[model samples]
Target chain A: MLRYLVPLIVFLGVAGFLLKGLELNPREVPSPFIDKPAPSFSLPKLHEPEAQFASKDMLGQVWLLNVWASWCVACRSEHPLLVQLSRANIVPVYGLNYKDEPDDARNWLRELGDAYVSSLIDYEGKVGIDYGVYGVPETFVIDKQGIIRHKVIGPVTPSALDNCVLPLVRKLQQATAQTVVKRTEVEGCV
Target chain B: MRSLTVGIVLLCLLVFVPLAFAKEAEYMVADPEMEKTVNEISAELRCLVCQNQTIADSNAPLAVDLKNQVRDMVESGQSQSDIIDYMVERYGDFVRYRPPMNASTMLLWVGPFLLLLIGVVVLVVNLRKRTAVIKNDEDLSVEENERLQRLLAAESSPQVAKRGNSSSQKAGEEKS
Candidate 1:
């Protein structure tokens, strides 16, 4: 019994170690960057001098935004959408340059077509905390009323624009126009 | 006001210089109903690449895709079970953070019992071999017994044995 116990103990120890090594639990958490007003952020451009911008400045317009790092492979996949976004003039595309070196971000922008209007260099990831950005390539759609209208946490789909964004932006724009008209009519009555 | 305008223009230059167009936060918005479902399903699925992480915690692209797929399915009127079944069909049992007990997964469920059974059988075999040895030892012949006695006598029959023998003889005379 004692002799068998040694082997059994060893087998149990080995099995425990193997189980620890084979522990395979992977998770994909959705970015908490959804539906929340874009975290207010102010950062300088990675390349241009003496220029800083924040979310407060973009309050009056509807925009599509992406948080990207130069090192993110998935961000590269969506670069073409940014280019088309520029050509389509659908809305301004803002970029949050996440966790990447300034030089690399600039070089990447040059290489992939600088289709973004302004990119905030979040070098130390302070803004990321506010937005709950788990990883790079997260996107948000902010309506003109300073409310987030939609969020796509990964790569963009072409249909997302045609099906979701265009209709939403139209509705928001119509709503804003109607509100202005109602206010003017009230002022005339007074 | 002049300085403010200049400041505004300067800031715009800085911001717009990189983007030919302003890049909006396009994908961060969530539909309330779909968002809840996405969160729920993501919490259940295990990420395959990063062990010890659920799909809700994993930052892997595949995990993100799976979360998106789960969201899509839930939005499309699939029940939680239906969503899980779809995932299991596509990615196999490993996708489930908690796999169900079934005949197909009997090994995962009952592997320790199988090991215990094998261990018991091996232990019994070894114990029987040892018992067989002990039983064989019990069947010593007279010559073998005498040989065993001689070996014991070598150790026991010294001056000490002489004293023990004298004492035994005294006892025998007394008894007589």
Candidate 2:
């Protein structure tokens, strides 16, 4: 009876775990860059080839670094939302045009309406690789200190933006503002 | 016939010319030792895009880029452990084909062995119970053995066969 019970318990336990695993989405791999410094890169601006943009350039502000390409189908779905967010001016959004032809990317932005403050060209996708971008249209929310606060893989849905991204941005902004106030107070005491 | 030979030569050229020129894109690290290390490390890293394949085996663009990155890091004199640490820092433990034993992955590492142990225990217990049942069946009472021997004798002897049948019937009734 004890032997029978043991096998039955093990079977039920394994079955339960398998059933739970089946419900999980394999694609939703959690990023390890959360709370870590975002990888730095310098590349030419998509519009202005002679001019350059670097991750260091956006060091003092909380921003969104969106990795996108003209060829990505899912990016089209998130384009309008990004455009809306850009209009709202909640946070400055920078773009990394990953492994795309310049003309195609320009045409895509022109037709869809540009939402980025400035889009950088990652012609070889080296910057995208540094950012651990496996899929296109991945977004990283970087805090003012350049730490990656959050990463959203796939298209940024409206709920994801509202519930997670926007709230986090607001919190980081407030934290930065408080830090600024503390610095000024310290200077006054000095 | 001369034209046919020329045509055959042309066909052979068409079939085998590309094969002669088909060189695999070689990603060679300058140092042979470093290249070996890079290969070993890459084989252990899972291709994030192709979940089932290792970075070394996968030809996906991301996998290729990762391999290139590993090669560059190796050439730059970074230790193998450092390179693995950098990858893990960026891509979590899931990026490793062989995940480290930790709280999150403890079950994953131990589950198979635990199941094997359970299987062994259950198998041993089952075998013991079966053997015990067989032993009990074999250890019949002395009276039962005598009765079995009498029934055998009656079957063999013609004179006592009818008497044996009646006596067996009475014995069966008594036993019941």
- Count of clashing residue pairs in every prediction: 43, 0
Worst 10 residues of 1 chain A by lDDT: A181-190
Report the C-alpha lDDT of model 2 over A134-190, residue by residue, as the tens digit: 889999988888888788889999988887788777777777533522221222111
Candidates' TM-scores?
0.43, 0.80
Best by TM-score: 2
Candidate 1: residue A97 lDDT (0-100): 89
Instruction: Give me the runs in candidate 1 sitting further than 4 Å from their true place.
Output: A1-35, A177-190, B1-176
**Candidate 1 lDDT:** 0.71
Each prediction's interface RMSD?
A: 11.8, 1.1
lDDT of 1 by residue, B23-85 (tens): 451235368867777778888887755756788888775566667667667778889989877
